[model samples]
Target: MTHTRFPKAVLFDLDGTLVDSAPDFIAVINRMRAERGRDALPLAELRPVVSKGARAMLGAGFPDVAASEREAWVQEFLDLYEAELGLHGTPFDGVEAMLAALEANGTTWGIVTNKPEYLARKLLPLLGWETRCAILVGGDTLPVRKPDPLPLLHAAQAIGVVADDCIYVGDDERDIIAARAAGMPSVVALWGYRLHEDDPFAWQGDVLIHAPAELCETRAWPGTGTQA
Candidate 1:
């Protein structure tokens, strides 16, 4: 693995990367289905699509709902999800310890997600991260979101860190792509959600970690230039 000086900041993708938000997605979708006299979907069925966002979750939840109309349901899905957000969501196993490690190492961290800014802000307090998180760049925070690379670059700049000094971590292909475009290093969170056929190795992240606990290892952070 390539090594460099420790990163000044570590920017994360919110939903699947930092938090296990699949439960909340299940709650919102089941609630919506129940209201419409439909059956609830299982977490296993919907979990993989949570990172894909509202439309994807809804598509799985309401398969009967046409793809064309799923876009329209996005607002309602997000609204209901806003209420159910942190109630069912928690940091993925080891996330707390990982954050603590970052703090102990004097490295700053923030979030850049496709979730809307208002919704992301609401989640901070619910997750008890309102004060601890250094910065947030939501999908609506900028003109474009991930895969565009601007949001990742913007988040680094917002926190007064250069792109090379920030590391982006997420579970999606777009996350690695954006980091590459921004000239930033990236870590693929293999513990996060993905479809049955999804191949993370192909994402080509600078590092691929199986669990948040793996991040606690010194080797996971390339900047230290030492194997754990």
Candidate 2:
């Protein structure tokens, strides 16, 4: 699974890699809790697991609820969130500039996320990325998803790139695991959300980007080796 440096395509994890979606997530979780006569969680408490998906947020907001109640609450949170998708989310700092730079250099890029297809599809339009992203592989797009390597492999195939010619950027351990399994290079997005005790340096991705702006510096990307 080894290869030369500099990938042809860069795949991103949506929630935390490309965008900081914590505000909207916090709002939705809090709103859902309020509806159930519970106190809303503060931002500090909710931001850590924003990239972990709805279940994590639901569990954080309703830790004492019965499992059945938590399931229903999670569904309600999703429904409410769908209506407010992208309301407070935005591409991370320098993300837009970095994407534009990639486009100018003819470097293909796309999204591979554990977010559900419907939600991911809905958010793209709001962010005006409906036609800009080269490809998108949602959690449910295939029989398997991230941490399985199948979805990441699918994204590369769909974009006409070999798995080894793709670099994945993500904020979670699953992202690195998937990239390694798929034979792709990977970067750990340091600006993304994580628990207080989480360690990005130990995640062991090929690169670590502290700010989205750093990504714009393609020639000097932290651990990209030399560009191809």
Candidate 3:
């Protein structure tokens, strides 16, 4: 259903929706592989799983390793990635413009992501968004993360907005599921990372956008009303 009013807040997933962090992931994972004497996987092969977090990337880069070992490797990967955070990767094209437009229009925006709070916060200064982001709720900020809805709910609360007054944008199925559970409208970010086997349509977001610039268009937002 199309909303007739502009949402009070817009929430986004950090890794894929707002930032193209695959380069950092690729760099660190490749470095880890090199340490293991394994050849580095191509960027194309690793980009899709970047949003799935370190564990997924580790499994893809080291498929031969036992699942039990992956748990330990996840911490190693996160440690390495934290040290190299913001060394590569930037906001997706048009993301800054979109955010600027939102602020100019008096619409508040925040980030809710599965990335650890400290890591996600570290990116703010690099992008010059340290003072601009309305709120930030990370995976570890609460007992549950995306697909659980609590993060989304807490983000809206943190920003002093109701769930129905917020719209969530994300690249993964779990994002949409969480938005739905939180009673917030959602937009699927088609420009973000996703496996070739993934079907965005199945996520059933209120809207789908192929590029960050599209977010500037009122039609790309969930509500049907003109920009507030």
lDDT of each: 0.86, 0.83, 0.88
Measured on C-alpha atoms, candidate 1 has an lDDT of 0.86
Model 3, position 82, has a per-residue lDDT of 87
Error of 3 at 124 (Å): 0.9
Q: Which number leads on lDDT? A: 3
Off by over 4 Å in 3: 1-6, 224-227
| Model 3, residue pairs in steric clash | none
Enumerate residue pairs that collide in model 2.
none
Model 1: weakest 10-residue lDDT segment is 219-228
Taking all chains together, the TM-score of candidate 2 against the true structure is 0.92
lDDT of 2 by residue, 169-217 (tens): 9999889899989988888988888988888788778877788777666
Worst 10 residues of 3 by lDDT: 219-228
Please count the clashing residue pairs in each candidate, in the order shown: 0, 0, 0
Tens digits of per-residue lDDT, candidate 3, 73-134, equal 88888888888889889999999889987887788899999999999998899889999998
Quote the lDDT for 70 in model 1: 81
Off by over 4 Å in 1: 1-6, 224-228
